[model samples]
Target: MPIVARANLSPASREEHLARLESATLEYPLDVLVIGGGATGAGAAFDAASRGLDVGLVEAGDLASGTSSRSSKLIHGGLRYLQMLDFTLVAEALRERDLLLTRTAPHLVRPVSFVFPFARKVIDRVFIGSGVALYDTLQSLGRRRAVPLHRHLLHDKLMTVFPALDGSKLAGAVEYHDAQVDDARLVMMLARSAALHDAAIATYTRVIDYVREDGRVIGVKARDEETGHEFVIHAREIILATGVWTQEQQEIAEAETGLRVLASKGIHITVPKDRIPAKAATGIITQTEKSVLFLIPSDEYWIIGTTDTPWTEDVAHPAATAADIEYVLDHANEILASDLTREDVIGVYAGLRPLLQPVSKGEKAASASTKVSREHTVMTIEPGLTAVAGGKLTTYRVMAEDVVDHAIRDSFPDRPSLTASLPIVGAQGYRELTAQRSEIARIREYDLVRVDRLLGRYGALLPEVMALIDTDPSLGEPLEGDERYLRAEVVYAVRAEGARHVADVLMRRTRSDYEVADRGAGAAAEVAALMAPELGWDAEREALEAETYRAHIAARLAGEQARDDASAAAALADAPEVPRRA
Candidate 1:
């Protein structure tokens, strides 16, 4: 089969994908049916399709709406994992990280430096420095070193590197490199690449049940959440990449024997970049009572997080409690020149990591989720059903390869994974476009900074977005509430990026939600009005969409104020749910 170039995920493409889903087995069954739209699922779809396998992927919500979008956004070899002495896992992740930075998605992934601050001089320096040296060594084992090696800095130099640090501590620091990315965009690019390879990709499509015959799973019964239409998609093999919802899916399928997945809720708070007086993308690794915490720096914000506590709340909306916020703020403030309070936080987001339930019995069973292995497991639950769980974002490509290779082991025994060599949708000519960024900016009459931002987000696909601007000069204007985003990007989200809801554009397609103080509430109405026509929403529907988004933001803020998870859940429950299409 020849590769086709209709890679756009416009409304028309979604309709086409839905039409194909309705007629899946009637025409012919797919070789593989993937259930998830996260990094793992998208990667699997692209991997399977690239190898000439007929595949279809379904997600109950927007692509990367779950944990994939809420990550700390680093692609590292897991320095903490090295403390556990997991050499193989670290090497594999480093290899995948290098592939992404250099070959697969250079535009989405870039090199970032982190400062490992040390308070206890000599002992701390040797301990952290040795681990970082090992990390650099493993990265060098890859085909190319995508980032720089680790360097040692004394207390004075460390203070120079991060002026935000408290001089009272007056300790040395180790600077090391890791790759960071827009996690949601990476998943979106994967799905688009899969669609370009002829894979049927459908979002807001929920798998209600499994299609079973003679005790062997054969396909899935899915519901199109957009139109409330139910359909059966037959496939020779089914791969379940659902993360935190894996256990729920297992129950729906009535799979008595399979890997059990536990959900560990992690939350991150975003503060304005100016609050952190840092010239570079700096991160600090500190030990929490339960697990380690990370304070990673992004372009215009500092993402401070992550409390690893067990969660037993609604999976869709994991609320971040006052305790969670305080935990992060307290630890993060420990090393800062100025303290960060709840008032300083502009945005907060929570995600659940789908950890595999450890096989330990009795008292050992009470181990913290952090102690659970980060390695992924592939299990053939039944004749035609396969499921994968417990891997990090950096190694998603390898996880996809493992799942696909296992699913097709009997059918296509000789076929090997080709994703390592395949550049995702926007990566093909990215370098050339980046080199010509100044020329493109001159021709388009935009500033060099604007063009550079576009290249960072779109890469070779920049022309496609520029075409939207050319069609409507108004699109070239900045969004009303947030000057960092262009109006054209909003239209592009709906017209080309498979964005079906107002929240999708605000939260994922653009960083308006977390970047601004109002949590995107200020831009809600404008965005809804812009998307109304394309999504076929009437005035009332548009109003409802805008109102629902505001409620969501309000609820999230209220949740953050609540003292505990239960109270946070109640506060989050205040948000009126967006009515799905019937």
Candidate 2:
């Protein structure tokens, strides 16, 4: 019965959040407070809120600005995990994958098929066939039976489905179904949905210290990164889901209770659609050397090359080197008929993964990034603080539920999780709404693809986007350089999505920065100018935003030329700097 909408994140909303915090501090001492704004944190907030617990979520930066935004964006039951013979892990992830595609967020997650091209003639088809079969079996055990099972492809049919493949080397391929999602948008929506359930959600707010009493963790001493104001709000419990930054949080918690976290970095590159022929399909390819490669199709470009390397420098922005790019291109090119080079690459991003560590000897030489682990661990280092680590994006819900369960097992004796049946904000009537997508296009005065795409990302919330177009018809026009996105989305990002700067609008809200060839430079100034009035910026602010975005683009370009992290980070030294746009 405590549903709130459109949180009024206006100046008024900030005051309301503070007032709520103060009020809740005085009443019942609150239930749970979550830290970090990535996928797991957002997931934890939703889980706790749905369970009828008083919850507050604090993020030092924008939601999903870290590794969550830098993911492969696939929501599949990791097929490779099946090879590891981890059935329990595969089953749980598949269940969540089904929930996202069918019920929890039908509009945000969509089914995508991948083709695993078999190149060796001596390799038994049954060996690869059995793995695909197990992957399909896991899908049936999930809540939604929407995705179809894997099918064997004949040599002729495989070539037909992917005309670009060099059939001389390829024996045949297997086609299987998985799902893809807009990872950043999903986290933002989860935070918004948790807010609707009365969870306190604030971005650009950092927890500087944990306030402890005697031996129990009580609350936190935090500062608004934007305004530099410090405040305290005592709570019954805390949950940390900071992703790669998990170790830093543990250090802070360790000050009081001694816990540790390890960081692993994963880097991904984006190339033009033309670089990879359309027939490659969006699926995982296991190289002869045992390394896995993902050829994913994004809205406007093909995403390729993800190097798993240990990282120890510049955690804020992981830099991709020339060597990293070469390694990826070298492996991926082995299968393609038309080879790709440096010119085809458009964007590159890297993120750190937080893996639980026992501090192995020679950990540095272990290997490339460990295959993404399906299992997650939750630890209560002290009386009121809980830390979770080592989970994939697909299984965030289960991780969240477990974290909350550990946090409140003693405090909230009567509460049970309601998130399993709870629908995210845009999920209401999603099927029926999709059924009316054609009609909605008529009423919204947009093409069927545009309307459906918007609906797909925002779910029942397409009305919010359409309402902006209604106010200014010009807002419906596509962005200056990117036709796949509409100009009106810029206005919506600031007004409703908590996008504070141009980078937020380009990099996350729209993804035009990585998807477009020019890295969204052509549209940056126009978008900044349009958002100025809404975000309360002057001419100087607009100019600053434009410069900052241009620098981001240049740094990424320069990063490609460097052979290692030192040169890569140095290349970005003069690229341009802006306030962190949360």
Candidate 3:
């Protein structure tokens, strides 16, 4: 097959997706209409589209704008689950991890190692070591190699690997391999992959109500969150992949959905890499009196905190409590000789996990959010509506395949799943494309590092990015502030990756929001200016974009200084009010 152009996902691309939806409307009786543009929703779209079925996916915000982008961004078998003797969850995640790291979405997922500091000498070492071994075994058992095997380290050897580690009371460390991802990018890729397979995908579209006929869900009434234009989408099958908001969606459906999804808030704080003394992929899992704490690493910073507190307030924006911050710092301080203060923090984010109601009594009530089942449940709440709840990021494809399979078995009764043998949009001949990297750099007259970065992130689609740079050599230059990103990256993000706003470019497409000190403030104006032509943004819209981005940076910085959530929210006082646009 011929190489496709960069997946145009800008307003132009949005127009294309919208056009596809209109075309589907003419066709009538779509096989699947997916709600929620999260990982599961995107994956379902891909699965359904690849199976020769008409599909439409709608999101209330930007793609991966919710919990999907807010994940810890790891693709791995749940090592902690092994402690609870949940072998099924571990095995399934391992298989998915293998698929992502190797065959399906290699451009977005790569292996990352973690060093678990051994505090105790006796049973803890044996127990933890056994778990890592089992984790490695599962990966090898999979069709593709997810990551390398785990290795044990002595105290002195561990110190050698991580020189900045506080040596006092450190017995040793276990080096185990998992995988890390740009979570938002992965979700966007899934949607794009679906689009490549002829799926209709739209962001900033909200479902206002369900269309019911004779006590059956037949379609939906949706309004563009941006434009406020209501349109009816009629589908033979509707799949709900909105996490945390599962119950709310069920209420809208008015179906006797027995499944109850509870939301638990998890907060993560980002600090500069230097703030943490240890360097060799350190992640601490502390056995707290009630729960466990994680200190994982992002590409540029250390991600700390993740308190599993039951939430009772707003589901859209879950705020982190002051106690949550204190809890994390206190636990991390136990291991570091030089303690971290509130000042060292650079970014803070919170996400809610969708927990499924357990069949066994007290499991639903007694379980904290972290302890709840990450395994998903698929149920036909009504004749045409299927609600899929309670799954982790690593297993999204499996969840999607399962959801589609259910629809086929009950509704269509003829189509079989073809997603397992199918590759995503960027996966075709990726290694061969990498082999031609020198020629690519020579063609673009760019450095190896810059070209490699694009290839790794965009895979075989790197040439598409380079072509734009070739047309305007100025696009080959690095973006301001975050010089690691090429100027063409911003263009590619909008034109090909379906990015709608400045936040989509910074936070998801490039990760400048998480990587840079100023959280992408320095380059926001330049990016907006570059995008103005394509988005048809006049002076007013461009100014709005710049101001909104600047305000977000200010709010995030101020939030770091505040001691509590109220103070943090107060810090956003200067944040520009985002003008609603269709």
lDDT measured at residue 423 in model 2 versus the true structure, 0 to 100: 82
Q: Using lDDT, give the best candidate's number.
A: 1
Tens digit per residue, CA lDDT, model 2, 1-582: 334344323334555765666555534566888998888999999899888888888888777887888888889888877778899989888898888877788878899888888865446467788888888877786244778878888789877777766778788888888899989998888888787777877777888887888988888887877778788878998888887777687677665543344557666678877666665445545543534688788765777756667776767767788888888777777777777787887777766776655544446533444644537889887788888888888888889999999889998867877777778888886787788988988886768878777887777777777788889999888888778788778887776677767887788888877777788888889989888998778998899898888888888778878887877777766564355535
lDDT of each candidate versus the true structure: 0.87, 0.77, 0.78
Best-to-worst lDDT order: 1, 3, 2
- Local lDDT at 91 for model 1: 96
* Clash pairs (backbone) in predicted model 1: none
Pairs in clash, predicted candidate 2: none
Residue lDDT tens for model 1, 1-582: 234346778898899988887677834888899999999999999999999998899999999988899888889899889999999999999999999998899989988888888888899988989999999998887366888889999998888888998978857988998888988989998999999988889999999999998888988999988778898999989999999988788889999667777788899889988898875767776666777778787767888888898877878778899889999999888888999988999888888898888874333454578878889999998889999999999999999999999999998888799999999998999999999988998898888878877888888988888888888888888888777778888888888788988889888888777778898888888888888888898999999898988888889888888888877877766674355454
Sorted by TM-score, highest first, which candidate order results?
1, 2, 3
Model 1: ten consecutive residues of lowest lDDT:
359-368
**For candidate 2, which ten residues in a row score worst on lDDT?**
1-10
Highest TM-score against the true fold, candidate: 1
> Model 3 reaches what TM-score against the true structure?
0.92
lDDT of 3 by residue, 432-500 (tens): 998888997897777887766777688877778878887998988899778979888888888888877
